[model samples]
Target: MAGPYWFARNIRAGYVGRDRYGKGVMPIAWQGRAVIAGFVAAMIGGGATMFLLFFYAHQMALGVVIYVILVIGGAGTFIWAVATRSDPDKSLAVYLAERQRARSTGR
Candidate 1:
C-alpha cells in the first residue's frame, strides 16, 4: 500500500508568487490566500486548545507536546503548498537585475 498524499491536485503554478526581494512567496490568487488563511486558523485554534489543555485540563507536558506538533505540522503544510503551487519560471532576482540595468541605462 502507498502512503497518503497531502497535496491538492487542482493547485496550479502562479497561485503563489515570489516576493519582490527574492526572499519568499506571497499569495497571488484565491487559492494561495486560502492556504494562508488555513495556516493562520490552525495556529490560532491550536494555541487556544493548547492553552486550555495546559491550564484547565492541567496537562502541561501534553500541551507542550501537542503545541510543538501543531507548529511543525502547520509549517510543513504551508511550505508544501507554497513549494508545489508557486510559479516555476518566475525569478525575483532576474526581475530585480533587469530593473537595475534599466535604471542604470536611464530607460
Candidate 2:
C-alpha cells in the first residue's frame, strides 16, 4: 500500500540509512502501530467503500455511512496508538527541525 510505502520512504537522503532518520526507521512501537493502523484501516475500509459504491450505486447513503465508519474507526486506532506512545509528537517535530537545520547549515 502507498501508506506503508511512503511511511517507509527514508528521509535519509544520503543513499543509506541513518540512525537519526525518522521516515525510514521505526525506532518506536507506537509509531509503527499508528502506521499499521492507518494502512490496514484504509485498505479494509477503502475496499469496502469501493465495493459498496460500485455495486450499490443506488444507495449513496450507504457508501457515505461506510466512509464515515472507516474514518472514525481508523481515527480511533490512531488515537489509541498515539495515547500509548511514550514519546511525544514533539520529538518528531524536533527531529525534523534538526534535520532541516543540518541540511541548511550543510552539515
- Whose lDDT is greatest here? 1
Identify the leading candidate in terms of TM-score.
Answer: 1
**All models, RMSD in angstroms:** 11.8, 11.8
Off by over 4 Å in 2: 1-27, 30-40, 47-51, 54-56, 88-107
Query: How big is the positional error of residue 26 in model 2, measured in Å on the Cα after superposition?
Result: 7.6
| Clashing residue pair totals per candidate (backbone < 3 A) | 0, 0
List the lowest-lDDT window of 10 residues for candidate 2: 1-10
- State the local distance difference test value for candidate 1: 0.63
Error of 2 at 66 (Å): 1.0
The Cα error of candidate 2 at residue 2, in Å, is 25
lDDT of 2 at 81: 50
lDDT of 2 by residue, 2-100 (tens): 121112222433443345355433323345656666858776876688677968786667777777777767767655554454342234444556668
Show pairs that collide, candidate 2. Answer: none
